[model samples]
Target: MPLALYLLALAVFAMGTSEFMLAGLVPEIAAGLDVSVGSAGLLTSAFAAGMILGAPVMAAFARPWPARSMLLGCLMIFTMCHVIAALTPSFAVLFATRLVAAMANAGFLAVALRTATRLVAPDRKGRALAILLSGTTIAIVAGVPAGSLLGTALGWRATFWAVAVLCLPAAVGIATGIRPAGRTSLGEPDHEPSLRAELAQLRTPHVLIAMLLGALVNGGTFAAFTYLAPVVTATAGLDPVWVPVALMLFGTGSFAGIVVAGRLSDAHPRLVLGIASPVLFAGWLILALCAARPVLLLSLIIVQGVLAFAVGGTLIARVLYAASAAPTMGGSYATAALNLGAAAGPAIGALALAGHDELAPVWVAAVLTGTATLMVLPSLRLIAPRAHRVAPTG
Candidate 1:
């Protein structure tokens, strides 16, 4: 609820816009750089790969620094990379800049999660995280579409320039709004865990399960979502113009879901995941079965959106709570694990597409989410005790 949390959300909005805006601009980028669209699509993969590799390493190195400083530095680097990306003439240069920008994005998010949780009461950590991550949902709803329009009107380069300009205010907000005392209160100098100790926490059973859960949950949703366009148009027989409308509806559902999940997670994270996982499985299953009904499919899309994001706040809360002693590293692992799932989901969907029809992704998502449900059942025993002990003390 602090101003600092909103500022962090602003930073996330800038990064999320940059991450997703590329999807809409891929064709323009391909044409501008004289490359194939398939090649240009690799730019998205590059950013995800950078986040997967950069997050834990950045967290380790940044373990000793003030969270505010790390966040500000990452924002500066991210902004500069976007500026270079806007100006780059070569595809290779643009790709490299995207990688750097994603690395900065990952670093900023990991630190932001830790900082946001620290800013609030222990019981409110889930809500704070949800508010921070809502920036991404907002980006999907508004920023990506606006960037696409901007690219059409001005140029893809202009969109990048606009994103760079957007970061300036977020960076200034962090520098001014977050105090040194707040940063120190999160993790005192004497209590800072060593890199080895933090890394060792990954070997804990509950922590590892939390990471796996994060990956599978994201993988399931994205497996279907990554190919939503063709499924909605060709399979569902919807007008192509309705694709953006469907996406906007999904984003709206996601925003609402995260807020509700955040509140539920404050009291019972396990129960939240228990309900969410089944909802996700059923949503995808129904979507697959009713793919030919345009109205039904659209309704299911919104349901899927809510179910997909409903688990997000709880997942992060579970990881941070289970690994409370190594929260920075745990947060980084959560980010990296989720990105790995993001990468894997599309690959799984692509394979399903190669062997089956467009509706295959929906079924694939159902199976993945169903598996996530089963995974959570066993982990509940491990997480419940920790949840009880972590009641808000401050």
Candidate 2:
């Protein structure tokens, strides 16, 4: 891997940590901010909404700038928002800061994918992207757990402060370590993709299938994960202190899964998703039925982490492969779609918790996961023939 990509991964790791660590600290955040826990959970939803809205918007703006500069600007925004979040006294201010951070995250990732791909030979783009996305996976495993611990030990404010501090290094890494790939600036490129051209990518059954499946899979995963704390504490009968540890264990599975998934994706994208889809489906099924036992609950969760992430690398690669026209724009749309799922997951899970409190979340997650697995049928047919094929020879 190139040094530039490594630095970009570090920046992404910090950003991913900040985005995901909130789940483990939702109760604390709600109490500290004087908001309902549901409202505190909206902090996560708000970020996902920002990503859903901001990815395309940023991609449009970034069309006019060099990729390197655009990434730097995005990280700067991310860093500043963390600072604002760390210092804010009121819940409203904190909410606003989260939006800013989300925008930065969405935009940076959209640009980073295109930039990272260009940094390597055409044949290596898949591997490069896999490496880049590993940062997000790594965050799930290590950064979020660490952040949760920090939030638990010192006030959640201290966690945000630490995240703010990380931006300094990330910003410097982008400034000095990352080098632009081509003479033609990312902003000034000719043959700009029209909105019509970009939208047409969605019309392709393959692209649409990939997007929908990505949304479904992510929705299912988040539906269960969003309420993980309550499930562990209330359902699994775990100590409050053990909640974050369970989350960390889940993250550990996710990190390992991402690495393994990346290789499997490069080799056989279709088979990887096909095999993992059922595992995820089964994991949720078990969680829904047997969540009463603490040990069984933890085991199911670890399995969920592994199975849920096992197909991620394949899914992202599929989007890029299926969308032949305006790949970057199409890819950004997929990113938006994934965020849309993220947004929907918690909202749906919370709604399910409205009347029947105890069994609602698990039932909701099981339904979503089952639905998601069924949705994969179309995507499977779409990619099966070429599943094991290598990158296109440019």
Candidate 3:
């Protein structure tokens, strides 16, 4: 694998940490900005909105540029936005920066996704993507918590400054690691994808369904993951200190899941998905029922995290492979799909929480995951007809 792939993951680690660390700083931000905690929470939502809107739009705009250029350029914008965020006093100004920074984050991810897969051979695409996705798992396990601790000790502004500064080394590394278009064959699009062709893929049944499956599965995963702290503490009656340990376990399981998926997906994508999806969903149902038990809840948290990303990482690889021909735009489709799910999942989980049942989110997750599993059958049939050629055990 290219060092550039790791650099790209570095970029993802910074952005992913920025994406989630806000949850820990909401109180600080609300106090500093003289707004309600709910208002500060909207900044996070606004960031998601920027990601959802920017993925396809910014990707289309940058398709003609060299991959390295777009990536470095986006990193600069993202970094500058965070700097402005740290310096800004007005809530509105900070919110504007989140929007711009998220758009840049969206663009970087779109290009990085395509770039990572292109760096490796077809059979290793899953592994390549797993490496990139590990940045997020690692960020969740380590970076976000670290950022929160930093913010608590220093200030929220210091946390923003740290995120901005983190981008510098990654920028330097990526600039050195990724070959420029003039030097490398893979660093630039051979042909700019036509708008019509990009749109056409949305109409293709398998491609469309694969993207939707990615979203649905992600939605289901986030539905439970978003409320995990509450679920373990309230439902399972674990002490508040155990919450962080639970999160770490989930993050560790996520990393393990990606590693496992990377190894199995190329040869057994069908079998993995067919077997894991139901098991994943069943795991959620079990959690919903047994979350009152601390040991079981803790154990299943790791299992659920493992299954969620194993299923998720494969879905991403499937999206990339299905839209392989549209090298310039494939990543944007994936970005849009996953973010759509990311946006919806937490909202659904929040709604489920309105009924006073800590386990309601788990039940909703089970339903969403069950639907995702059902959706996958048709996608598998269409995306890989060879699945029909393989034995039932496969």
> Which prediction has more favorable lDDT, 1 or 3?
3
Candidate 2 lDDT trough over 10 residues, lowest sum: 385-394
Clashing pairs in 1: none
Question: Where does the lowest 10-residue lDDT sum fall in candidate 1?
Answer: 385-394
Q: In model 1, where do residues sit more than 4 Å from their true spots?
A: 181-190, 390-394
lDDT of 1 by residue, 213-255 (tens): 8788888877887788898889988888888888888888888
Candidate 2 lDDT score relative to the true structure: 0.76
Best-first order by TM-score: 1, 3, 2
The ten-residue window of minimal lDDT in model 3 covers 385-394
Per residue, candidate 2 scores C-alpha lDDT tens digits across 29-131 of: 8898789998987888788888988888887778768778999999988988888887877889888889878988999988887777666654455576677
Those runs of model 3 whose alpha carbons end farther than 4 Å from true positions after fitting are 182-192, 387-394
TM-scores of the candidates are 0.95, 0.90, 0.95
> Among these predicted structures, which one has the highest lDDT?
3
136-161 per-residue lDDT for model 3 (tens digits): 89988998888988999999999999
